[model samples]
Target: MTDFSEQDLSGSSFDRVDLSGSTFRGVDLSGAVIREVDLSNSRIRAAYFDGVRMHGVEIPDLEISGEVVRLVVNGIDVVPFVEAELNRRMPERALMSPTDVAGFWEAFGTMDRLWGETTDLARTLPPEKLHEQVDGEWSYIETLRHLGFAHACWIGGVVLAQKSPWHPLDLPWDEAPVHEGVPWVRRIKPDLHEVMDLRRQRRATVAEVLDGITDKGLGRRVTSATPFLTDATDLTVADCLRVVLNEEFQHRLYAERDLRALGAG
Candidate 1:
């Protein structure tokens, strides 16, 4: 293995170079244009591909799974179709889009039970391994912290009208703007139990909101304004709560995948 730390390789070109099975860790490949590149059988994980434009590419049997914002294929947006197919496969996904208070409670209860199982699986692994990032994804502790941040932003700030509800350990999305008073400390290596305690507190806050929800209240608008959110405009209470539920559901899946990888390692 070659170590090229702190070395500048600008304007370098490799033609017919054999780089198969080479690992690129913490390497910067931004703003570099490639032409006629053969990326067959390549495996990419937890990498950013924002604002990328590809043309004349022959892609067969490609499978992508992540948070896709806008994916246009053949001059058509397929995000809705993809989402519908996913919801069809997992009928329980419909619970996340509940229109009434009773449905919301049921959805929350389901998520609570599912998260309990996920946490139990994580507990079977070594404590130190829980902090390890699998395939460059967020560590188990970081995932829990991010979930707490989602609850703080959506449930506490938006629904309850709190100006700043973020905790010091709350982890924001990578592309989220720097908002004053919002926590974004990525280097804070917290213990698994410590972060789980914070998560329990946030979950209790959600429970409080769920217990007091009414059908009329679900349709009510969230008037709280926070810089953490992309838009400051008012949103329906149902929409805000749905966002929180989706975060919990999806992040648990990611955490479980990483836990399995850690156990195998």
Candidate 2:
């Protein structure tokens, strides 16, 4: 059981090496070439795969969950097909990608309505249950907190040019990088009302932004001063709002699923 850490193993070659059950953390595999590698029952998390290509691979019973774009598999880009099927199933999923002001309004409206229903359903659960994690997922309260963080980052920080727009209870995603002056506390057990008030405030801010948005406004580029997103200058106002919408919609679905497992909803 040899251990390697913080070592520059660049330009190294290991042919016919047995590395089953090896742990790789903060390891860079960029520009590495390999053939006949077995990754069965292997778990890769918080990793980036860009401009990668594979050939003559046997991939079955494999499940990938994350942001995917331009993923060519077997001479077919499956992203559009996956998106079409998701839109067909969820219907409102189509609204997340809006092309006009009306569509944006509708998309946000749908999110507001659905989140309203979800929070109402959450209120029916035991107060302590709201803070309990299901299947290693975020608790209901944490979901709301993360959504608030999303709104603050995309809308307040980027569009409104706020240097620091994070609430004390704001919760970033699990894989988010540590940033100074940003709240990422996970052990604080905030009550439902406390978190709900924060959510209402954030939602109102988004609503106000939507109220005066024009098609031209949507196309205007926006940048963030937050250290995590300082390089996101290519984003437009519409792109930022769509990110918030996607986070809200997906997290609500996860909350609902966890709520059902908690014997509520």
Which has the greatest TM-score? 2
Stretches off by above 4 angstroms in model 2 are 1-3, 15-18
Candidate 1 lDDT over 1-265, as tens digits, reads: 6767777887788887877777766567888788888888888766788887788888987989877988888778899998899899877777887888888889988998888888889889878888899877889889998898888888888888887788999988765677777766878888878998998899888878878878998888877767776473468888998998898888888899889988833
The top-ranked prediction according to lDDT is 2
Residue 83 local lDDT, model 2: 86
TM-score of each: 0.74, 0.90
lDDT by residue for model 2 over 1-265, one digit each (tens)?
Answer: 9999889999999999999999887789999998889989988887899989999989887888778888898999999999889889999988899978899889988998998898889988999999999978899999988888888988889877888888989888776778877866867989999998998899888878888889898998875557668866789888888899898888888899999899886
Estimate the overall C-alpha local distance difference test score of candidate 2.
0.87
Error of 1 at 87 (Å): 3.2
Candidates' lDDT values, in order?
0.83, 0.87
CA-only RMSD, every prediction:
5.3, 2.1
lDDT of 2 at 226: 70
